[model samples]
Target: MAAPDRPAGGGRMLTGVTWAVLLLGLWLWGRDITDGSGGPAPTTGDVAAVGRPIGVRLPPAHAPLRAAVPERVEIPSVGISAPVVPRGLDRGGGIEPPSFDTPQTVGWYDGGTKPGAAGAALLVGHVDTETRPAVFYPLSAAHPGEQVRVVRSDGSVAEFTIDDVQVFTREHFDAQKAYGPRKDGRAELRLITCGGTYDRATREYTANVVVSAYLTGGSGAAA
Candidate 1:
């Protein structure tokens, strides 16, 4: 994900032996994941990709925010339903991800817009941890029109529909685009995780898979 001090986020790691085994599996014909470049963790004001919109286009929402805290997040399409943890800046001033020990957890950037608020809300997770896939391993497969629900502590769910899911290389990561509003004044969401191939030399994925979505319907949504 393209955010402020990104190196501090997406803490998923693979030991040399583990990565080698995974790469060997890849060599036998498997999914292609890229190697990632080091950067500041993704911040809301950070991503803005240059060029044509790589994500799907969608209309803005007229709904207002009805909840301030998010509890759980569910993506039935991918069989993902996990706890949502509010994360803040790390010592390096980057968005921090949940510890790798809890690979099923997802982290939302507290400094950015809330999930149901009008703006881009970032939800980050690891595509895979050192030994296996994590909560967002299937994130890249999320398609347009799929539902992504965020259960709020207020007992309301903020629902979103996937609009776009694209992979951005670390070198070409547009902080503005990755974290920016796909459409002005829309209550949008960005689900990000490491993707592409792992680089043995750099010890990170080369690209990121970012899923863009917008508020659709939810009990917490404004009427």
Candidate 2:
């Protein structure tokens, strides 16, 4: 018997693998990823060749690895209030827990590179907990132009205004579409967490909701 959905399943697997590979490549090329923040200075000729913005790459040793310490995150509609931490990648390639102890503050993936440079600056948090609630619990309900404030350690704050919220099936998550190219030379941010219906058998959510925004204004540091 021919199964109509067999092709769909295969396509989903391929999409998942491709997304995973793109993320891995970004992590491996952290220099190029964060080069947008004036790390490696690209020549005028180089920029002309690409016909797009190219981030300046800095020496690996001197690369700005320090995360932009967030003092607070305010989502008026969702009523979210918490601190942000620098998050790193896990051995399995997924985002590591934002914090080992609190698990309430959001974390930026350290391994992948910082946000606001060239590539996507990924911020992730728990939607909820078994015993108590956590940050990003109400993320799925956020609307466009909502404010997200991130205070850094250098006495500056990065304010982001939400542009859109998108929900993607776990089987069809696309990294390039989610974190790839941007026309403007401005920095971008992405907030991700599990959402959609819960699958008890798999013990996972059916989809992931991503909130993307651009850096509107800030003080202390660049990223």
Candidate 3:
């Protein structure tokens, strides 16, 4: 599910400035999510035509399950299988991402909703490093209707069905649209990574690739 070539840069994959901006958006998203008014409903035109899959029959959302800490996340269609590590906001007030040293790891925002719970669970990873393609390098190629499986610490698997994939440029980012739950009371998941072209002049990715999915089915942990 890899996108076209995205040559890498010499320094960190995602800069602090970018994360700060994203954190600002997420901060507002958190407030909206807690109020049971999930920002705004997503529109097909809200996503780029190329990323929006049309005419695919999506399943009804499964009822949200008990909270469970995610241990790993898998996107079989994109060949992504990575460990989930809990992360918190950094000194800069941005949600910390997995370190560059371990590009294959996915960072989960422990402060937010857990994978199988009643709100949006966030997972972030690097698209590529300076030397090689990272775990989420193929993320942009993932289409709607795909599946994302999260193995939880409670020994249950939470299955989600992809509904949207968007590439939000830094110039025009809507925090609520990118991070808020699409619908209140449903278990939602968001896989995020750097996207768009890498601008050597600015030393940053021009956009972020956000894949949105909702719980469709899952097995509960043994009682």
Which candidate ranks first by TM-score, i.e. highest? 3
Q: Candidates' TM-scores?
A: 0.72, 0.65, 0.87
The 0-to-1 C-alpha lDDT of every candidate, in the order given, reads 0.64, 0.52, 0.77
Candidate 3 stretches with Cα past 4 Å from truth are 1-11, 30-50
Deviation (Å) of 146 in candidate 3: 0.4
lDDT of 2 by residue, 92-209 (tens): 6544555425646786666553444444577777654443445765776676656766666666666666765666554554565555544344566777654544543444445556
The 10-residue segment with the lowest total lDDT in model 1:
29-38
Instruction: List residue ranges in candidate 1 displaced over 4 A.
Output: 1-62, 220-223
Q: Judged by lDDT, which candidate is best?
A: 3
Candidate 1 residue-wise lDDT at 3:
27
The better-scoring model by TM-score among 2 and 3 is 3
Cα lDDT of model 1 by residue, 1-223, tens digit: 3222223333354334323333232222111111211122222322323222446565455475764777789999978899999887556445666778888899887766778888778788766665556788777667776889988877778889887766665554546555667776678888877655555556676566678889987784342
Question: Global CA lDDT of candidate 1, please?
Answer: 0.64
How many residue pairs clash in all the candidates, one count each? Answer: 31, 11, 0
Who is ahead in TM-score, 1 or 3?
3
